[model samples]
Target: MSTEQVEVLVVGAGQAGVAMSEHLGTAGVPHLVLERDRIAERWRTGRWDSLVANGPAWHDRFPNMEFGEVDPDGFAAKDQVADYFADYAQKISAPIRCGVAVTSVRRNSGRPGFTIETSEGTVEARFVVAATGPFQIPVIPPIVPDSAGLTQIHSSSYRNSAQLPEGGVLVVGAGSSGVQIADELRASGRDVYLSVGPHDRPPRSYRGRDFCWWLGVLGLWDLETPPAGAEHVTIAVSGAHGGRTVDFRELAAAGITLVGRTAGHRDGVLTFETDLAANIAAGDASYLALLREADEYVDRNGLDLPAEPEAHLLGPDPACVTDPLVELDLAAAGVTSIVWATGFTTDYGWLQVDAFDEHGRPAHRRGVSTEPGVYFVGLPWLSRRGSSFIWGVWHDAKHIADHIVTQRGYLAYRAPRPPQ
Candidate 1:
């Protein structure tokens, strides 16, 4: 196939791609964005039906637009979030081609940039930006052997409780997705057993402010690395039920069983560690530590935020945590389905470049790769703690766009100027 040429080529058309396109357009850089599916395809399909933005609508949006007339504190539905990106792309007049999948990306030895092979055709570009987000590949651990005969699904494919087999569900992983799925399943009258893991529990709201606000003001969001001892900790906050603190004990009281980390499964029987109590205590400690930091910040600044005394009090441990069930027979528990919310990892198999590290992850300094003309955007902690979401992606995209312009000896074009 004949190859088309462009100044820049961007892969993926989600929030990151669209944001990058917007900045690139402002910088007068000729670029084309390629998407394998429709715009915002992940939000429209990868997420569960009841899924909502983990961040509030006010804070989850790009700086150029608000989330319509929705309440700022409320969570926007998954479809709404998708539409937001689609609309943003349109508003910015992004040069995007949906249904175009990038098959391979390689350094063009004969040229100064990359040779991008796409489903439509090949493209030679002076620069390339891999704007694919972090959640590329869903990770489902092989804890449950195939002989178990239980229907298995990843949280990414889960739609609603009605989609599962007519029985209990064993949700492995207690991060945001796991807890939300478990909560929804139990509310739909399905027995749910959530596997507890190392997680950080943050209140949805405290002191008349959202926990996200606290993180922002306390500078937690800007930290390049997680706090000491919080490494690899999954946050257990939820936007469901009008936004509420995720208390596994409360979930237990509501008839959902909370189990410790899953060890292994054989012949339809699952085994768990006897560390449920420790996991709960660890979450509580993180919660209290966050509150203490916020309290100290308040005292230092002499802010008028009211103290939330109840937040500091820990209620009695639930039976599931104290005397946890270490073994569970899937058939006995009536669990016919299993939802693995373990998490995701990036996939750069298509990119045959030296831009990755030994671990197969993109190695870059604030989105600028060591390889010239190779840039990455939208990976978590790529620049700051807020590097993945809509707001953060915008800033990261601008930084990348600026870097691209500066590298090419073009003057940086700031926004708020009339389009040429």
Candidate 2:
């Protein structure tokens, strides 16, 4: 196979890869970016239809460009987000080659670099930045039994409710994606049953400001790891209906049956834990904690923010919580479909480097792996709480680029002088 040499090689031409290219160019590093599919392929195809960004336009963008014509407070459609990254790549003239997939990466023999094997050819680079953002592989729990032959799909493959079989849909997982899908399915007049799980219910907007703004001001977004009891908590906020807080109680009142986490399956019958009320209560506790914190911040700083009188820490328990279902016969409930919005996991089998932990996650400190010259970006909590955000990726890219520039012996590979 043909082989080429480059100073740096970045994998995945999504927003993270593109951002890395921009920073490397600014630092005058001779690098090339490779993508398995088209640029922003995940945003282009992996997401469900009718999905919008979790965050609003203004806050979920790169520093170099603004989402033109998109309302600052309004969430942009998924296609709009993909288009924004594509347009940003064009504006910056990012050196990206799409449709070129990297098959594997191994340490170069007798050298201080890596040998990357791609579908097109081979590339030898002194540094490799795995910008393949989070949400790489869809994760579907194996709790569902195989005996029951029903239509099942991951959230990544789910498109619309109209395409589903005409029957009740059981959406397992109460994260942002799960809740959104359940809401959409229920709106389409399908009987929807949402499986509740540990989640954080933050207000979409509070005291005349978006929750994102409050998080920023309150320094919650800079945390390196999730708070205690929230390690597996999925954020249960929605940007639909012009952005609103997701209330499971209200959802139950709106006719969507709520069930606890899936315990096991037997004889075409699914068993649920008795934690429905506890799960909802946990979410409410988080919601109230955030509001109290925000209220204190406003009062301490003497900021003139409006008060939400209706915002309370407690309310009457919904029927789903008070009397949760312990089991459901798929046939009896008429549930014909299941949408698994469990979550995603990264696949680094192609990366043949000892830069991972026992759990197979990259063992890195703020994108810098213990294995020299191997870097990571665009992962949740990589460096901070917002590391996976658009702007967060951009900043992390800059930091990685800077590290590459300042490393020892980097002066030997400085940019070549232009022709005189």
lDDT to native, each model: 0.90, 0.90
Model 2 is weakest, by summed lDDT over 10 consecutive residues, at 407-416
Q: Which stretches of candidate 2 lie over 4 Å from their true place?
A: 408-420
Cα lDDT of model 1 by residue, 28-68, tens digit: 98999999998989999999988988889988899989999
Question: Can you tell me which runs of candidate 1 are displaced by over 4 Å?
Answer: 228-231, 410-420
Q: Lowest-scoring 10 consecutive residues by lDDT in candidate 1?
A: 408-417
Clash numbers, per candidate: 0, 0
lDDT of 1 at 191: 91
Local error of candidate 1 at 54, Å?
Answer: 0.7
Candidate of highest TM-score = 2
